[model samples]
Structures are given as C-alpha cells and as structure tokens.
Target: MTSLLRISTLITTLSFSGLAVATDVVHFEGKASNTLPEAVANFSEYNDKLEAVMEGELTPEAMSEVHQLSYTLENAIAKMSKELDSLAETLEEVHLASESADTETVSEQGAAYLETSRELVE
Candidate 1:
C-alpha cells in the first residue's frame, strides 16, 4: 500500500512538472517574440559603428572602442544563431508531434517555433 501511494504521488508530481514546463515555454515564446528583431537592429548599428571606426584614424581610444563594438556585434550574432537553432528544433518537434497526431504538443511547439522564427526574421 505504501509503495502504491508513493508511485501515485510520483506520477502526479511528474505530470505537474511537465505541465509547468509547457507553460513556461509559452512565456519564453512571448519574450522571444521581440528578442530577434532587437538583436538584428543592434547588430546593424554596432557593425556600422565598427566600420566607421575602422575607416577612420587608429588612436588608442578609437582602437579600444572598435574592439568593444566588435565584441558586442559578435555577441548579437551568437544570440541570433542560438535563437535560430532553438526555432529549428521546435519546428522539428512540431512536425513530429503532428505526424504522431499529438495536437496539444504540436500546438505548443508550433507556438514556440513561431515566436523564435519571428525573432529571427526582420
């Protein structure tokens, strides 16, 4: 009896945990909705600033600023890449879920994919 109770409790806990993760994905989707476009804009601005610095004179302070701007641009590009990768994974999951006729999972993954895709595109 005790073992049975423990098993049931464990199952319930695991079920709730899955639900929480699903809900959190939706929240992340909302946040990701704006992240991609902002990263792109920042990347462009940083690239332009870096270019101007490179084309101009090469003083110590200018070199320092250029390095900083280059670092910032690299970070932005990395972030965009990560978001794109995540979007790709979510799309694959959505496709698999649909193929398996798991509508709920497909919807959740689809929403996540859409959010990430929107962020990646201009």
Candidate 2:
C-alpha cells in the first residue's frame, strides 16, 4: 500500500513537471540558411543529426535536441518547398510547350529547369 502511494505521488509530480516544461517555448537563435543550396546543406546535416538522436532512447535531453534541430530543419524544408514549387511550374511550362511544338519556349524553359535542378541533384 505504501509503495503504491509513493508511486502515485511520483507520477503526479512528474506530470506537473512535464506540463511546466511543455508550456515553455524554446526558440532557435541560430540563423536559418538563406539560399536554396545552403538550406539543402543544412537540411542534410540537421536531418542526419536528428536521425542519429532518434535511434537511441528518447530521454529528455534527446527530446530537447530534437526540438532545437527541428527549427533549422523546418526552415530548410520551407525553402526547398518554395524553390521546388517554382521549378515544377517551370518544368510544366516546358512540357506544355514541347507538346505544342513550341521549340523556343521549350528550349528556354527546359534550360532554366535543368540549371536549377542541377543545383539540387549535383
């Protein structure tokens, strides 16, 4: 009975402490990568670190690390998403032009697409 009481008390204490921690907002002060290339590099680096951290037990410290890393990762993803959206539009234009036998539009848009894509792939 005594052990059960102690366990209940401990659980209650931990629950409150968790709530306190959850209420606090942690901010990432590090500068986010500005360019697409820089954002891509940051995404790769941070994602590797985040994966490594996740492979182990998720203790408080590891969770904190994850929280901090997520900010940079999110920024990278946002930049990539924005750039890729524009690139996809360009590729679509190229495809449409090619279907209509518009050689000039196809050539222009195709080159633009390849140049931007190479930056991501290579």
Each candidate's lDDT (Cα)?
Answer: 0.76, 0.91
| Candidate 1 wrongly placed segments (more than 4 Å) | 1-35, 55-62
Q: Compute the lDDT of residue 25 as modeled in candidate 2.
A: 72
Model 2: per-residue Cα lDDT over 1-122, one tens digit each: 99999999999999999999788878885548788888889999999999999999999899999989999999999889999999999999999999999999998999999988887865
lDDT score for candidate 2 against the true structure: 0.91
User: What's the TM-score of each model vs. the native?
Assistant: 0.55, 0.80
- Tell me the alpha-carbon RMSD of every candidate: 21.2, 3.3
lDDT of 1: 0.76
Tens digits of per-residue lDDT for model 1 on 1-115?
A: 9999999999999999999966752111111223678778778788888888889899977876775676667667777888778778889999999999999999898988887
Q: Go through the candidates in order and give the clash count of each.
A: 0, 0
**What is the TM-score of candidate 1?**
0.55
